[model samples]
Target chain A: MTTAQLLGQDPGWLIAVKAVMVFAICVLSTLMAVWTERRVLAKMQLRTGPNRVGPAGLLQSLSDGVKLALKEDIIPAAADKVVFIIAPIIATAMCFMSFAVIPMTGVVNLFGRKTALQLTDLPVGVLYILAVTSIGVYGVVLAGWSSGSTYPLLGGLRSSAQVISYEVAMGLSLVAVFIYAGSMSTADIVGSQHQHLWNAIVLFPSFVIYVISMVGETNRAPFDLAEAEGELVGGFHTEYSSLKFALFFLAEYVNIIAVSALASTLFLGGWHALPGLGFTEQWLGGWFTLIWFFAKVNFFFFIFMWLRGSLPRLRYDQFMKFGWKVLIPVSLIWILIVASLRVLQQEGAPRSAILAFAAGVVIIVMAISSLVERNKEKVRSADLPEGEAPNFPVPSLPNVQSINVSGGK
Target chain B: MLTIQTPEAVMFWFLAPLAVISAIGMLLVKKAVHSALLLAWVMITLAIFYIAQDALFLGIVQIVVYTGAVMMLFLFILMLVGVDASDSLTETIRGLRPIAITAALGFGGLLVSLIGRATLGREAAGLVDANSEGNVQALAKLLFSTYVWPFEVVSALLITAALGAMVLAHHQRSVPRATQREQAIARFRGASLGSAAGLPNPGVFARHNAVDVPALLPDGSAAPNSISATLKARGDMLESTQFELSEVDNTVTEEK
Candidate 1:
């Protein structure tokens, strides 16, 4: 049976159990993700990270959570109290909601009742994920605006614009996946990749775009201009304190995990064993698929940390420009190509002809892109004379006399 | 008779009143942000209704488009325009209020009558068969086949709208923008060259690095200009004398 049908047949008690399981997994993964990010980042920067809490600081996040909860909660006098309280709740809840449709395992036996390890898989499952995430931005925006502070307000506005722009690119990137999988339901998309090649390998461009867009969407480093510390202080959650601040932190990590899981579900093949290791999926009565699923998720999460550790945050204008001028347009063009390819395949085109057609499209796209780049370079060079710096203000250094260390007699 | 499953029926009943009340609150709210939030809530309810009716594709699209994108843009604009900027109740346009009330009533009556008539005329045909293949697939089939022309036209309309926005937002510089060198020259040529080296860094040398501390000038007096005006206004600045060294007597009168 299809995963959705299997999920539908689940009893009420079983559904509740599965719900709790999904929640537990999300929370646990978030804790692990935090520890992993810190440890990984610390190692990258040549520092010891969080080794005092538990074994290798395994329980550090838990301790941090307790500390955050116990700290004094201060409500800024200028803040709109109601929205301030609601914002983090909204953020945290929405992140959890996105996990409802993500399949973590194949059909598994629970108390002698068979069920798929997922919540309800709506016909518009991927769209639902996108919708919830889009709503998730509201939390940040409201938090910033309600704070009644300049930095928070600016942060909120930046986040809104950033999320909105990247969301378009993110949505368009998924179109290619939808076209190839012929479904929007996460389960069906995963099933489509069962024995076939993963969508990441098949639709490589879409995978690349999706990966980029997800980072931007989740407000992770390099694309995390919303809460840029040097610029907007703490960004949207600047006014939040104690548990409220922790809630936003939780929401951020949860969002990262959500997008990672989604990337795995869409591109890496959710719950499916790696290529040539399909037999392992049946190990431990098929429960081992959960491990495979999380392994893929961690792979994406590692990429997030790697980015945070290596790349500097992008300037706001440059980030927005890339999103609008580069990612969105490229994804749009890629969608067109994918749709046309799907049509050609439907019409029973010969493999060689299809391959040649794809190659021609790629070449043309590359040629056009290169031409645009060259034109841009020419314009830039034309704007300035050789050996002359672009006109910008730079203060001249004062002439300093060399200090005599020895007393001259 | 319309048939809704028990769970859906419960959800509809619970959310319907909240939706209507929020819609009313959206109109009555004084704060633009609050109004936007109320409207978002209403839109979410509508999405839930669509989903309950098994129009999953429509429901999700409604959310992603209306609540997520459109309402967000609305809120963004409202925030930019000043969230506290409310319309004056004093009508500048004479008779505008009366005209608006009449129009609203007429529109409300028309919608109520239309929906009532439509619902009373037939039994609700659930989406079971239509969604047998899958709601998204079924919708896609109709959209790509039967409604293709309208879809294309709508897309064209959207593209035109985007282009129009770009055109509207495009501003031509009345004068060429000053280069950095020009700006620097203009700055240096102005009343005083005191600021040519840029504002002094805040805080007294070696003693404190806090932004609230005023820097010590060459004569050992506090430079108020060194500290942020905001900090000064907030009465958070520290006295520079506290960090300055006390004077010492260097006379040889200690010969006794």
Candidate 2:
């Protein structure tokens, strides 16, 4: 389909076709996420990760789902039965709903008809994703709460805090994107990235913030505080077993794909052919965008798996401190800078003058701040006792113990 | 606008039974928190009923603001105190005496009310927003233009509710003053300094016999269930922590 037709041409069945394609994308990507996570994690520990399931465990996630479903289902006697059931349902369903707004390609011709590749693009699609994702945390929160167990409750609270902290940073990161595109809708944002370069080049700081935030958003490693087994065993889904547990697992990977895809679509030229690139011609457009999206998504998936294998899980307090103190403040300042520059650019401020002014302001602020900080540090050191530890909470669980019985279930 | 006449219509059909059932459930639930939750659910279904009558904006806001945010405030308070079904105060009326009488009266009253007000023009007058389409943007414009004063007043209402909630949730040290804490610390420091003379300090007593107790249960031991029973008998409430049985269970027969 020509770009003109693509902009405005979905009659009836085209909508259905696009919806089917999105459904397929979610299912396929979720499978790959499972395989990618396991294989990489196994390699990190010098062990095989489901090499027996399919060729190098290609169908590993599917096989695991089948096995999990067939296993004996157990509900903890103490669990809140209805809430426990509803938690996973809410999580998985909300996760699936995100794909509805995720634009895989611009617009594709479906057998003599043209429509947007996404299922349904709302005017506030980005906010819609944000809304659904925020609500998704309730699934984890209630899962932990309704489990009526100590570990799960702690896990749930940790997850909720983790998601909240990072989501704030994530929202801050997207402010730049919204400023550039002038809309929060995913499709419109993608269309804005139609030129040779995407927001990743123009708004690299925002891009970096978004990358960090998405990792935290999906509960990926180094930030997976909620499901830290060495701390809170199995985290929120500790009590869930069999098929119910599988649903949570499925939701996590699908969310990973969705989050990564969002980062790709927003930052990378989503479906738009690269400058001097041959793959974006009209004949190859629909299929090519699909490939382009997957390539960027897989690149992120690799990073996620690599981090999981490479880094140790952050301490809960440190994890929280990083999100709130470091990520949030930095991203907020970056967004302000971006907005200021954008405002100047719109008002016809010369690029060099704006850059020079921004740099000079940064240096002056840094120098003055450094001098003030030194003075405060000197005073703080003088006031503090020689070797006394600063007062803080005693991190002691009132009546808790860890027990791990070794068995292959 | 279509009226149905079917076999199940009188007993249970469409929104009627759901509305009645949820309303009943809201009143009868044992936990105050769950009753509020049930009340929220009833309001949600009624909102859906409004949507069916084309009041879309009202339906959405009812769920979004009321169910999502306000119900959370109620749940948050419930969680802070950990009140549940077991702590609920039961009523005097039993054996369906009150419920049966209320249901009979309600049924008769509702039937009479429905028969008397079945005409369409009565609802036509009662229907809100006869002048405009009630979509979100339109409603927002109407709110800002026609109801601008009330709109600003609503912000005041929200702020007032927030402050009230904060005041209620806060717990102060009723036993001792803030100055007493500093005084206790100062007395301890003074006592440490003057080791040459053994002196009983009167200022030390001002801290109110504050026992510096270490962690009650050491690691790897089950919490003593006996203490919980002791607390129960003494009319002290449990903290609703994750399962720590008290030490009073073994002493129960002895105490009796």
Candidate 3:
């Protein structure tokens, strides 16, 4: 594909403008996301969050940023001074870097030059995103270690572990999309989806898995064991103050938008209009597609807010177990199914034949799982004492009161 | 956006020395955590070197794996275990340090020789051709088709190593564990043999948060709380540390 088609390799000035615009979009959207999150969460809780700052608290995040900028920046006596200072900057910067590959809209006319609305696209665009996010873990881990404090250290470790675990599942989920699209390029993935149905519909399980992984990836509520306020104090940024703390905050919201945009790109058809709303794109062209893209991204962001307001933070161990044992395996199975289907299709298998094969595979898998469950049941039943009835307290068990008295005596 | 051009020679000269300095710093740093961080910096510089050579995929992977996951693991372990608990100065094995130095020197010599013999960038000459087919796909095709067996073998080995690690780390208790109900009852009855310190004091008594009022002992003297009592009992607390310099001076003068 031509550079013009894949991405707008525009004049240097226009490209610079696009870069500035992307930065502005990320920062502005983060401000809006923070405001929207507060307002939405407040509405959910039957309270107004920050109406005093701007209209419906639109400028509340801005004020908070300003306040943070003015706060006393404390570098703890024992902290590794350099790492401590650099960590938040790394976090925020790395978070923004992933947006370089995101296809914001279709080809658009800018300053009388036609170009696709993206910063740049690599052949390994999706992998580049994964690599960047992986590197972002360093910011947290380093921040925690450099703090020279207990809570931040714990928080940082938890964040690293959480990111590593969920990232695997997230990567696996995307593999199905890559298989279906036959390319890893973000623009190509979107183009492929436009040619057919959205990957979210075709690969429903992968989409659901990606949604869950994105929440976990961003350390949002339910999966946010890393910064469980009830347990970890302020988490990795506990010792961070002033602009440094704001940077971490900025990185987090930016990351959320980036991941949401990625989810839009990968599964929701990027800047493509909704299937039923194709008329909007047809009439308005590329600009309307940007609207659809942002709308989808914001919709994901809304779900993120709803989750934070609704769900309790998951226990660290439970979160990890779910990531490793449930999500990874399920995604693995789904990828297997998708890969086989693709291979069969490539081999000129008829549609019905492919569907039948998929059904047979699913049935076999279900049967095996049920068989294992039945065997477990049998083993558990056998392990019970002969005199014990199922679901009843066994008489052979020691009496709690007597045991307590004996221990005391 | 500004049409920035990379001067590869300048970048290599800059990053290569930084990488070497950090690698040496990683070895010499007294703190394990600092050493890990230094290693991460080295890894990052190496990634930049890869990027300079147009191996963008390799560069990203280097950062993603080495600097990110591996270094994080090292730092995590260092931090969690406490930086103070670093390896002891005393070598457990006799002549181990000399042997280690000799081995390292020999390895370095071999590497230098190998590098001097081989034409540098010869292997990398194929990078442009690979880039034409898309680096990721090209690399993937080569790895899966040409080096397929070795790749599969390495993957299997990694899996085996993971399984082995899990097995080694697994602890099977010889004694049956107490039921949660039993443990709860024991705790409630104050019958559990919790620790040598007995039940911890609910109030602050010593160190940073000393209370103005002390606990009255059964014999009427003010009793030390958990932390102070533990320290005193273990003979780790110095008597002079608990009092003012004037009081200690007075006591010493009176004794003299």
Candidate 4:
């Protein structure tokens, strides 16, 4: 059935319950994510993580949340008090708002009220998430400026630039999915993925680009240059304290959850079981799709934490260059190729012919580029002084064993 | 005619006033930062109106483009330039207010007259109902097909604006910066000794000593640093001087 027929079918009470449930799920997931990150990271570094709280530190996140709530809230005497208070609220609210559009699984019956797993699915649901997350940047920027300090302002500015740069790539990467799915609705996109191979295989380049850009979009390490502790202090939330600080912290982890959920929805086939091992919706009842969805999401979450533990933060210039120069252009080109392939397929062109033409085009482009590069190198060498080589450093190779049974050199 | 009980009517009554109030606040606010923020509020309220009308694409674009990118650019500039209340009090352009008011009134009049003359309708021609296909699909169909040229031109305009900004921001420095090779050569020739000049004798300056050890002069007396000055100022220079007990026997004997 179309999304509209499914939407608004539930009574008002049901809708409210579903919304509360969604919020609860988000909070629970974030708490788990926090505890897991600490535990996993500690284990990776050969130390025990927070184990004083409820059994293996599962309730540690809750206690941390409580501590944050009870901490003394401080507003700098010189701060813009109103904006300082409003900023974190905006951040947290926007983060929660994007969760409404994500469909956790296929249709589910809750309390005899049949409804989609999502809160509400608009035809423009994906764009709604984009718009909501984009507005989240305002919270960070205002928080920085309202702090009446220098470092926070720097952090805020860095975040704005980072968001804008990565957002373009993120949006472009999604375009290929839209084209392939022939719809912008998240539900429809998932449905389309079921008809063919998952988009991860079909749109591999877009998938890769989206993964990279999502990391950049959420400001997670190694792209978390905005909040680089070695530099901008605690970044935009430097001046925030108590519950206000907790709100920013909550917003950040919630945003990570939202983006990971989105990535799963977009590229990992939403709630579909992996398209192997003869799995189907009827195999173990359709409700098992929820497990698959969360499993995929957790995989992405683990990747995020692994990256944080392994990779250093990217320098700001290198980060921006990667976004604008590499990611954007590559995605743009991939979109062009995808678009043309779709057009050719629609026009009844033979698959072999289309593939051959695409291959030939790529070869010609590469050949021409290589020829141009050779000519440029020849000109550069000819312009140099004949006998004087530039004093370029060459380090000797570290001690190595030479083979004895070799021809004379 | 719209009924008061309708959702759109209620939304209009609520949000329109909010937008107006915020817009007014933007104008009347003292701080430029506050004004910029209030302007963002207005933009957001307008976006809400668009969503209320079921123009989801328009609403999302409104927030994403104007509220997100444009106002962000505005606040970034305001904070970076650090414009305070004192800066706004000075009139940089003398006698320009009257001209601006006249121009604004003329533009408003033109807009009003155009609207008044146009045929007003509750239902516009060739328009699909809001519950039809997704507005994004409808927009894309129209944008990529019939209205493609104008859309491309608008993007080109945006590109031109970006190029113009780059050009305007480019500055050709009057004195070129020293290359790394030049700096290295200068350093090797001892022409670029840094922080070496104007430095006080290491053991003589109080701050220079790692453990706050006092500096010593050639005559084995404590050097006249800030530490010695504080001791002298307090009239305990003779009694508290560590140099007298340690190595300033000659100077102490002579002074006494």
Candidate 5:
């Protein structure tokens, strides 16, 4: 049976169980992700991270959660009380909601009933995820505004603009996938990749764009201008304390995991085993597929940590410019190419002809890009004379009289 | 009669009242942010209703386009304009309030009557066949084939609107922006040279490195400019005299 039909046959009790399981998995994975991030970042930085809580500090997140819950929760006097409290809940809830459509495993037996390990599969599953994540920004925006502080407000504004800009690129990037798969449903998209080349290989540009946009979408590392510590003082959560702050933290990590899972689903073939390990998918009544799904997710998560440890945060204007000028336009062009190719394949065009057309498109793109690069170079050179330092304002030094320490002869 | 399933019926019954209440609250809320939130709630409930009716594609689009992008832009503007900004109750135009109330009532009545007449006594046709090949595919087939011209026109109109917005927002600078070098020259030549060397560091030559301590000038007086303007305004600056050389004996004493 197809995953959708299997999902439809799930009993109420089984659905409830699956819901609880998804929630537990999300929360547990968030904890592990936090630990992994810290340990990985520390290793990159030449330090030992969190070794005192449990074995290898596996329980450190739990301890931190408790500590946060026990600490004082301060509400600034100037804050809008209701929205301030609701913001974190909105952020965290939206993060978890994105997981509802993500397929974690193939059909598996649980309590003597067959079902797919997903909460629900809407027809427009991927769109649902995008919508939920878009709403998630309200948490940060409202948190910043309701705090009634300068820094948080600035952080919130930056976050709103940043997310809106990247979201356009992100959405456009997904268009290529939808065109190739011919469905917006996550399960269908994954099933389309079975025994075939992964979308990551066939539609490589879209995958690359999706990866970059996902990082920006989740406000991570180089694109994390929203909570730039050196500038905004914790960003939108500047005034939040205790559990409220922890919720935002949890929301962030969960959002990372959610987007990673989505990347796996859309581009990495979801719960499919590796190229040579198809047999493992049949083991354990298909429950072993979960391992493959999570492995792909962890691969993406590691990239997140690698970026966080190595890359510096991008300047806000440069980031916005890249999103709008580079990512969005490239995605639009890629979508056009993919759609045309899809039409050519449907019309039974000759293979050699298709290859020639694709190659011609690539050459044109390269030529255009080189021309743009040369234009930029010309502009840069024209802005300043060769072999001369660009003039910048420098403060004049204070005049000091020379002190005659040596006595005159 | 429209056949309503148990679960969908339950959800509609539960959310319908909440949606109506929030829509009303959107109008009643004093704060712009609160009003925006209420309208967002209303939009969400409407999306849910769409999904329950098997229009999953439309429902999600409603959420993505409205609650996600449009409402977010609204909230972004509200935050920028100040969250507490509210319209004055006093009407600027004479009899404008009564006219507005009457116009709203007439509009609402017209909409209710139109919808009631259209949907009344009709069996609701479900989307089972339309969605047989999948909702997105069906929608795309119609969009590209039957409604292709209108779709293209709508897209063109959207692009035109965006271009119009850009034209409206774009402004030529009335004067050339001052470059850093020009700004520096003006700073040095236009005014006194007290700040020509740069503002003095706070807590300079002080007992501690706290920012609240004003720097000691060459003549032993506190330099007010050295301390932060915020600290000075808040009366948080420490007494500079307490840390002066005369307050403590400088005689070296050996420990026994």
Candidate 6:
């Protein structure tokens, strides 16, 4: 029933097989996400996407990938070739590695053998995911440095700093989930939420923080200033073309899916039996779990694509300020509140009492912040002349370019 | 105790060949950038050797920090301050240097073999369990437990190195950063490419578009404007020299 049970039950070779499958799924899913994004966006805007390719343009991604591979591989004359080449490889590899532990559709029939859908689920699976995803920043940083071109270099640098900043918020946001689940193993976390109540419902604030941070982590829409086409031209992969470019794109979408799947598992109860579906031990118990798991995952994936269409891209500076000043602080406070609730629960306090205490704490904190802001504003109003420009850091070029290209005026 | 059997034998699996190739590559590369790149490869392969020795944390730190960060700094400095291979071309220094480098290469190979013999020659694959021994969890536990002092020292070393880099970058050298460049184009942010200064009016540079120079800096040279010299050095200086062809007709045309 727990993640450890799922992981330990399998022969190690099944894990190896699942790992390979996860890698394939990520690569294939990314291709699909790309094609779907284009097609769906086209339908929204009354433009044709790649209709003439394979059936329903499903195979267009395949053709594009092939063409990209066959294209001329041009290492920039002013670039660091070894680093440039290795950057995308590392990015793509790390992306593949993240899904190795993800429960796709838990437990599937593999040549008559039943096992957990995950590759290798450890007790510290949550920390493992964090550690693995952190490596993604290396690709961005290396891509920028290796290119030796100013813009790509800047884009890489921005994305790395941006990712590291958001990861803190993201990591903090995860703390409450860990506390609620009482285990870091993702499968265990899901199993702990078996009372028909998801962590997303129990820890709504933490869930919100995690969702925002997840979008930022994957360098998705609004948070995708690193590759803002208008400003960066191509961002980190500006100089990269052919197969190398495809790899970067593949890594982005794959990482997006992996992160989304993780979100589903942590907050939405991974691979749990949906109320509508009949539960049966007649089927391979583990494989049945995978089916339920993918349902939640697919829904989240659609949300990712939907958000891409619905929202406009975010400004760079605004994104950073939100992550560092807003998200981090909010998550930290939420974590403290969650910890207090856990302590109260251990001490035999009623759930209602704990909830009331949390609400009171939130209100008091809000009142204090507002009071401080008002005092600061009054002091500033007394000192400054009318129409005087507020001093701010000389906005970095990519930050400026994002605004300028989007016709921000 | 985790015993290493025939440590000398294990080191030879990679270290023997790695040491030879890196030493030869470093000395053979004429360009400073090329040599530095070669040296990074050497450091990386050496780290791989470390990984084989069951030091996962060291391997990752070597890759993430040294190859990723430190070597990057080395390359960036090499580009930001362009090097002249011509400086290494003094006839008097060259004759003696070849012998010196050749001797150094031989000596290096001998040292690698001796080290390999001393350490890995004794290490048998039979000794290593090789099963998840140096994984992140295992490595973390090891660092926090018995190896805590060395682990703490490593962090201090990293901080010191970072501060030292900052200081070095800020220090004023005899040559200004921009001046040493063959064609330094600074503060000219016209377009995203920022290659406009490097690019001629197209018509002036070549007739048939036979060359991609000035408009393109050669690989490894950050100075886009200095690309003409790079191309000339490569003996691919476009189709024709602008001085003779005069494709621009003196006044420049705005290219699309």
Highest DockQ model number: 5
For candidate 6, give the DockQ: 0.04
TM-score of the second chain in each model? Answer: 0.65, 0.45, 0.61, 0.64, 0.67, 0.41
lDDT of 1 by residue, A324-409 (tens): 99999999989999999999999999999899988999899889989999998885565332232223322322342233333442
For residue B20, give model 6's deviation from the true position in Å.
Answer: 14
Best by lDDT: 5
Candidate 1 docking DockQ: 0.35
Q: Native contacts retained per candidate? A: 0.44, 0.00, 0.36, 0.40, 0.49, 0.00
Using TM-score as the measure, name the better of candidate 1 and candidate 6: 1
The DockQ score of candidate 2 comes to 0.05
> Candidate 3: where are CA atoms >4 Å away?
A1-8, A282-285, A350-353, A368-409, B1-6, B84-89, B93-95, B102-126, B174-256
Ranking by DockQ: 5, 1, 4, 3, 2, 6
What would you estimate as the lDDT of candidate 5?
A: 0.88
Worst 10 residues of 2 chain A by lDDT: A387-396
Residue B119, candidate 3: C-alpha displacement in angstroms: 3.6
What is candidate 2's lDDT per residue for A6-120, written digit by digit as tens?
5445756677777677777788778877887888889888998888877887987788778999999888888878778988987888788888877776556667655657776
What is every candidate's C-alpha DockQ against the true complex, given to 2 decimals?
A: 0.35, 0.05, 0.20, 0.23, 0.36, 0.04
Provide the DockQ value for model 4. 0.23
- In angstroms, give how far residue B125 of model 6 lies from its true place: 25
* Per-residue lDDT of model 1, residues B62-181, tens digit only: 999999999999999988987457767898889999899999999999999999998887876567778878777788899999999999999999999999999999999999988665
List of clashing residue pairs for candidate 4: B204-B215
Per-residue lDDT of model 6, residues B128-207, tens digit only? 34335435556567669989998899999989998997998886779754432222322232223344333433332223
Sorted into a CAPRI-style docking class, model 3 comes out as incorrect
- lDDT of each residue in B45-147, candidate 5, tens digit only: 9999988888888989999999988899888888888756776788799999889999999999999999999889886656787888878788889999999
Candidate 5, position B136, lDDT: 77
Specify the poorest-scoring 10-residue window by lDDT in model 5 chain A.
Answer: A388-397
